[model samples]
Target: MKIRPAVRRRSIRDRRDPLLTALTGLMLLYTLLPLAWLVINASKTQEGLMDSFGLWFAGDFALFENIATTFTYDGGVFTRWLLNTLLYVVLGAGGATLLAALGGYGLAKFDFPGKKAVFAIVIGAVAVPGTALAVPTFLMFSQLGLTNTPLAIIIPSLVSPFGLYLMWTFAADAVPREVLESARVDGAREFQTFFRIALPLLAPGTVTVLLFNVVATWNNYFLPLIMLKDPAWYPLTLGLDAWNKQAGTAGGEAVFHLVITGSLLTIVPLIAAFLLLQRYWQSGLTAGSVKE
Candidate 1:
């Protein structure tokens, strides 16, 4: 037999994409620059914050002292804000994810009347900026006596158009038609099929939606600013803003270091959540990419 001509495989360098590499580098710089500043300034004293370079340290290290002040100031209000933020994240994101999952799965798997209308409404709602709805939401809740309460935040957050859309696409792509039919043939109830069969395959998309909702609720300021009047109901975003404002008034109680440190502290949990859940996200993204 005649020998086949040698096939030349592209080397890694030959496969490299210049545009993607440049975009990745730009994104890295954009995301990390502020974080680098936060880390540097958070370790400095107030004087250092005022006098030193933003990306470098000054004369003294005050990280521990600043952390201590951050948690202990005003009877440990920062701790309270942290706890409040956690509560909001758990309830709001959890509810949003649950609702999105159920609604998305139903839309994808079931036949129902008004389905097209529902889809149209959801898409339209997505186009409407949430900030634009803040006034209407505040009014509606005010009439219902839900303003100034955690429910005010949770209720609004539970309705996420983007999350619904994401889960709908994911559910359609991830849960195969035959698997769902097999579940029905096995006499599994609808809810049982969803919770047992579809939910597992939906994990990556669920995590993505959960992460986004968590970040949104965690960083929420405008809604809470308008809805909540009580300090006890204030999330970290509001608490931090209040602190920053107080720091600026004449003869104001300024703890710039504490502010910097607290802001840094605010981000750690979200970062941890992303790191822990990244594998699931990657797996989910590739799960439907190929047909086996």
Candidate 2:
């Protein structure tokens, strides 16, 4: 009798959620529609792009040609931009993640002097928009002669207040102090206790921070736009913008197809990264729930 009542209530609740499901479906459609358009049009030649409906494929598949031209154009400058973007992702996001992990762990576990002041400042920094600091950052870097260098971009990308906060909160909840005490009793040093036990427990929070930092660093534009002038230091966002400008010129070759194709190519690696890391991400999100 009790099971029957519970099942009936669940069914009623499910029926009542149709509006929620419909809203979710609508949101998915809205987000995916632009991506679908990009893929469809990327397959078209310049003439095909102009002649055919953007939602459908053109008569000739020009995706390979567009890709070849995108890479080979201007003595293969796009390849240089690709390599530069990868370098930024590696040095920038990687260092940000490492620093956030160490700092978050210490903040969560320790009771050092001035800790409250540090926390307040970090929380306040999170409220200040990065864009608002861009001009000051540029001016500071200019004085130091770091402008137009990889260090200009990589240095600023290392700071992620939100990432640090997320990890701190996660460490507080996910890692118990009793475990640290036990490790100490077993004669393990503080760093060993952290590396062997706490770091594993903090995996999910770390991945969450890492993914956000990676995406932020990958898509960053305004800072780099102000900081860098040399084409050799250009990341993909600025490089694509330059290509876009050329496409819009009155007397230049309309490489609109290349722009669209390059845009499509740019997102592929990010999607792949998300898919690759999703398993770890999911496991991390569920880490403390089982209480094992």
Candidate 3:
């Protein structure tokens, strides 16, 4: 039996699709190749890292040894940096998300004087890069004696205009005015209605806002570099930069492996956090995609 022309064309298309898919897979691997090298290099000793292949693992797996040295070196200052990062992540991101929620809810639900002006200011703020304000922020914190303190990082991280915009956009669609009206009809107080009714609906938005803030604060380097002089107060990003600098200098090869290992470890928490919270973000994205 001979195959039909349509069937042969369909088979050709199907075969071409696999080739296209393989090309995409290869591109993804190329993109991720550097990270793979980081992981492989992190597991090797200084000599192994210098002498061995970049893509393959070393014969002696020194991951645990590198981790120990990373933590204990400089009197376990890396642990302090890790703690500082966690504090910044929780306080900065959490506070920013809360404020974004309140601001967004207010913008969405209330009709008030100067609302347009307020929104315009927010949009303008969003356009301004965070780095542009770092110098002024440092001066302000310096006057207040907040430089070198965790507040120096957390305070700035809490003022994310992008997060506010995202929440505002989400609230405009996800939260229904009829629901708020019904709550008012039942004699629910404004705060009560917001906490009970609006907040639950805003969960997905809140999660997304939190995730963005968390990642930004975690990867923050420039602000901390300008604000903090004390190594003890360093976040992981600043600490890693310091390590990278030292690794390039003489007699720093012993700590080179530790730096690579620490860099790998630093990103693990962020990956875990996103993996855990992604469902809420995914749902929030699709929540208002369809209308009744």
Candidate 4:
């Protein structure tokens, strides 16, 4: 028999259109430009910050000095703010992720009355902006005598509609019905089945939701602004804003260099978290994209 003609496989370069590559390059530059500027300016002294261009490093690489001062200045209030931010992230975002996973698994796997109504409510809540509910949340907390407390921030954060929805969608596809049936047949308890089997399978989704909630809680300012009158309870975002405001006031001590460094410091953890968990997030996104 005659050999079949060789199939022409598409090379990587042939598949990548010049227009799409250019557009992607432009998007990458747009996203990274501000971060580059921030990094450059964080290395500058106060005089350099004032005298040199923002996008380039100036006299003296004062990044390390600025960092040390950021931690030690004002009796180490920056350290306190960092700790508060971590506390809020752990309690609020962590709780939200746990709840979302449980609720999402239940919604996906169980048959219950009022389920349709619950779905409708979750979808509606996701569409509602947190800012719109800020006033109402503040009033509710005020009436309960919980204002100016960490609970004020943690409570609202525990109810993440988007995270719940994300987990719900992910769990539906990620966990097969047959696996649950097999686990039940093996006489495994419901909670045991979830904790042992479903939870491991839901890792990617959980990490994704956790990251979203962490970012949201870490950068929270509006809710804290309304709820807390105590500087001791302030998270990094709120504390940083206070510092920036002080710099702007007449006769106020200008620690603009410290502010720049603090801004850079604030994002370092987020960047680390993203870098570490990026694989999980990517897997979650691409899980069902291809047929096995």
Best by TM-score: 4
Candidate 2 residues 202-263, lDDT tens each? Answer: 88788877888889988989988999999878989999999889888985446788889999
Q: What range of 10 consecutive residues in model 4 has the weakest lDDT sum?
A: 1-10
Off by over 4 Å in 3: 1-23, 287-292
Tell me each candidate's TM-score: 0.90, 0.91, 0.90, 0.92
Every candidate's lDDT? 0.88, 0.89, 0.90, 0.92
Q: If ranked by lDDT, best first, what sequence of candidates would result?
A: 4, 3, 2, 1
Measured over all alpha carbons after superposition, the RMSD of each candidate to the real structure, in angstroms, is 3.8, 2.8, 3.5, 3.6
lDDT by residue (tens digit), candidate 4, 123-187: 99999999999999999999999999999999999999999999998998899999999999999
**For model 1, which pairs clash?**
none
Model 4, residue 17: distance off in Å is 2.1
Indicate the residue-level lDDT of 198 in model 3: 96
lDDT of 1 by residue, 208-268 (tens): 8888899899899999999999998899999998888888878664666777899999999
Off by over 4 Å in 2: 1-15, 283-292
Local error of candidate 2 at 208, Å?
Answer: 1.0
Q: Count the backbone clashes (under 3 Å) in each candidate.
A: 0, 1, 0, 0
